[model samples]
Target: MSTPVLGNNKRASCGPGNGIRQNSLLLFLLLALASCTLVAAQQPPYDVYPEAKPPYYRVRYEASGKPGELIFPVNYTVWIPPQCETLRGVIVHQHGCGEGSCKSGLTGAFDLHWQALAQKHDCALVGPSYEQPQSADCQMWCDPRNGSDASFRQALTDLGQQSGHPELSSVPWALWGHSGGGHWAGGMVMLHPNRVAAAWLRSGVPLFEANPDRKSIQPHELPEAALKVPIMCNPGTKEGVTVKDGRFAGVWPANQTFFAEVRGKGGLVGVAVDPLTAHECGNQRYLAILWLDACLQARLPETNGHALREMSLEDSWLAVIDGKTATAAKDFDGEPLSAGWLPGERIAKAWMQYVNDTNITDDTPPSAPKEVRVVDGELTWAADADLESGLARFIIERDGEFLANVPEKSQNPFGRPLFQNLQYSDTPVQPLTQMRFAIPDGDDPQSHRYRVFAENTAGLKSKPAEVAP
Candidate 1:
């Protein structure tokens, strides 16, 4: 028997048998309906993302039926390092508005590069995807005051129950947001100052004064407590700096207003301009991670359920509004309070490298790949990413001699080479970077002892990891 089903706006025609009984036809129709596939109910775009296995947890929420709640369904994915008895904080990688940007959040927790940062601080990493359509008003969710704040906290509680890490709900959050996501993170800093360790706003920022052009944007007041959280505003130079008069021309101006308002009020905020591209997130995550790492190191509460540590201003670094690089506070001759505020020396150097060009150089090598094993004709291993300079590729050796490079060549078009080519979402391109090497068939397998070396984007190589022969 043939059945007709309508899906994806297409309909199929079914042929009828002559003189068929109406009751039998109805029964046949029911059977056909039961087996037919409906495209209308198809899984969402986010479903294509990688699965959340152990050490990683995921939760989904439908819009609450109550009034004034999130009008769209939301998904939250979290990753926790294995063997951690307790967690210190949660680092959120928030995406911008629109379906394409929001869908990118699906793979956020699975990004190996980001996972390295979370693991180092014993903090959980969270990616939240709100199923917002292209036409929806962004302010509804981007402004956390619009019910997302409550929903996010609820998800944390729910995730804590699911992952057995109850501390997830109590720990402070280090936020990294792009575009509309930046609005949410900045607003959170304004709303719950004590709960935020730091915030990095890329390409978008919440306004301190309501703008006549954007009447819907509710302004947030800077409370005294909010002034202490380390904040960085990153916007592409083309947005307004270098190439003005484009779609993103207002981005830099908005960022400036946000920075000025925050910094003028004793707020620990600074601006880092992306000198390369505009609108699109280009090489911003690299700097964002570096800044957040420093913040987490200096600010994560010493004990769980405690207030965030205040950053010391003595060791601070200052950079003039248009300076290429920052100077240590001690050496700077400018008015301390007027310049951009960088947390400390390490971040100051990194910030300088990032603002001048997205080419951040690393002096150290990545950690060596470990647990190397060969199965059948393939070799596999594990490695930790170089937080300073991300992993680029792996060098394979046979009997201490060069065999081949895993990814024969680098493919990153954005900036420096990276192992898993970086996507705009700050995630490694899908089908995660293969740490596997195929043993050449022509060569005698038994005669070869394999070793792999981790390579960073700076072209520095790590000590080789050998496999048992």
Candidate 2:
């Protein structure tokens, strides 16, 4: 497998020790490696991906094995919100390089957190899983110019037709990618910036200047038109920020170069450091969703086939490059082109919270469950997720009295508790959260009624939806 750029390989430099010579140095290096390994192990292993159920359609392509073409088979899964007459765009949740990340892509469309953003804007969610083995060359697929670009476009065409939403092929896109996937997403933005509304690259970016060392890697040129699309570079603090050694430590430098090159040119690019992680995604989806949502609001066209609206920077917010706090761009004391540009004030605050730690909060409660009814032996309902905070769990009420919570124990191995169980890739885990609760036994069929209430991660609860008689 083509490993990502290890900007720095000295484990001691990125970890606990600065200068230790002798047995202590060996111990420090060993501990540093162990620490990185431990953090990565916290995420679930890539075993097998789940099946694509209803409302979720999938298309697959085989490797052509021809020159300059995708050499691996790939599966593209798409989820279109129900009752949608048309689609505004598609959100691409591209996973990083490696078997685990590739498999995680299969569940990207199933993510309720991301789905909330798409559903709110009437867009489709797409997850593409490239069937590359652990020992294969990741560059074969991570680099969009390496044939995956053609495959990506083709998938949209097929998905648009398969989902009966032919507009998907022509709609704009909001991209969120991890690691090598980040590289791919950023590349797409550079190549097709007009169609891309925005992009969030977590620990990856495309090369602005060509590297003579990499014959297989071709550099992308910065186009004036591409500056219209907003982009963000996210890298872990350990990746050459706080720590300067270890695997993936190069992520920070790569992101830095990308940010400087783009931001220096007055491009709408920003950076957010993941203070609590190395390469693993630790609660980044919260901030990413917020940014993309704002971009969609400002960029999406008013009508189905109209051109995207232009976003002016006259009243935008700005923060010091890689700084935690943000304020009005006009008041920014630093150089205007060098400062990080935020969509607005709301996102600026959220970005600060995320940079310190992924502790973003939501004040308002989620909407109450709708169309509550008893089906067979379970009480089912429909609900939308809170834009600020995602759905945590449901309160099963027996005649207005609290009975139980769907996930009795609310937990988020990656970050804030979520009903869908957020994974490392910002996607939901297998066996996605259900909106149905089993009917408690011992209640007479005609005598007992049920009400379901929605709750967000912030502990706010919504009004109850009573089950129909």
Per residue, candidate 1 scores C-alpha lDDT tens digits across 106-193 of 6678777788899999999998877665545566677888778887888788889888999899999999887778888999999999
Computed on alpha carbons, the lDDT of every model, listed in order, comes to: 0.75, 0.75
Candidate 1 lDDT score at position 27? 21
Q: RMSD of each candidate?
A: 12.0, 8.6
Q: For residues 32-66, could you state the per-residue lDDT of candidate 2 as single tens digits?
A: 21111011121221234555555887777766556
Where does candidate 1 stray beyond 4 Å? 1-45, 211-215, 442-444
Instruction: Give the clashing pairs for model 2.
Output: 14-244, 14-245
